[model samples]
Target: MLVRIVKMSFEPSKIEEFLANFETVKTKIRSFEGCNFLELYRDQNNTNIFFTYSYWNAEEDLENYRHSELFKSVWSKTKPLFNAKPEAWSVDKIASLK
Candidate 1:
């Protein structure tokens, strides 16, 4: 499995907007082809910082989603809310307990 993690820091004023947008699209994202799981996390000490942790069948599947119209639409709205450049990582699962 491929593990994808994205770290995003948003402008304080845009956090609610981002959460609302995510609510509207989370299901779509989770159901995308080869997507095994999806989740959003917030930094405990930094409320404006968030992360997305997901599992994909493969890198190709993730790429396909990234290039899809769904991604384009979501990103168009999301990119502007950022206070810092977003960071992402794609890695192989080394082990898991559940």
Candidate 2:
């Protein structure tokens, strides 16, 4: 499985817009091909900072999703809300308790 983590920092004024957009698109994203799981997290100390954690069947599946129309649509609405360039990582899970 491939674990994908994306850290996004949004302009404070745009946080609600980002969250609303995520709410509308998250289910579609989670149901996309090869997607095993999806979650959203917010930084306790910094409300504008958020992270997306997801599991995919493989890197190829992830790449496919990234290139899909769903992604482009979601990203177009999301890109302008960011206060900083997002950071992402695709990694193999090394260990997990549950």
Candidate 3:
């Protein structure tokens, strides 16, 4: 399995707008092929800072999602709200406890 993590900082005032967009697509994203899980997380001290953790069957699956219209539109709308460039990474997991 593949694990993907994205850390992002959004403009304080646009946090809700960003989250609303996320809500629109979260289910579609989760149900996509090769997707095992999707979740959102926020910083305890900084409300505008967020992280997303997702599980995929492989990087190629995520790439397919990235190339889709849903991702394109959501990312387009969400990009303008960024306070800083987002940080993302994909890892190949060798083991899992659960």
Per-candidate TM-score against the hidden true structure: 0.98, 0.98, 0.93
| Rank by TM-score (best first) | 2, 1, 3
Encode model 1's per-residue lDDT on 44-85: one tens digit a residue: 999999999999999999999999999999999999999999
Better of 1 and 2 by TM-score: 2
RMSD of each: 0.7, 0.5, 1.2
The regions of model 3 sitting more than 4 angstroms off are: none
lDDT of 2 at 78: 100
Model 1: CA > 4 A from native: none
Q: After superposition, how far is residue 72 of candidate 2 from its true place, in Å?
A: 0.1
lDDT of 1 at 89: 98
* TM-score of decoy 3: 0.93
Q: Could you say which candidate leads in TM-score?
A: 2
Q: Please list all clashing residue pairs in model 2, or write none if there are none.
A: none
Name the lDDT value of residue 23 in candidate 1.
100
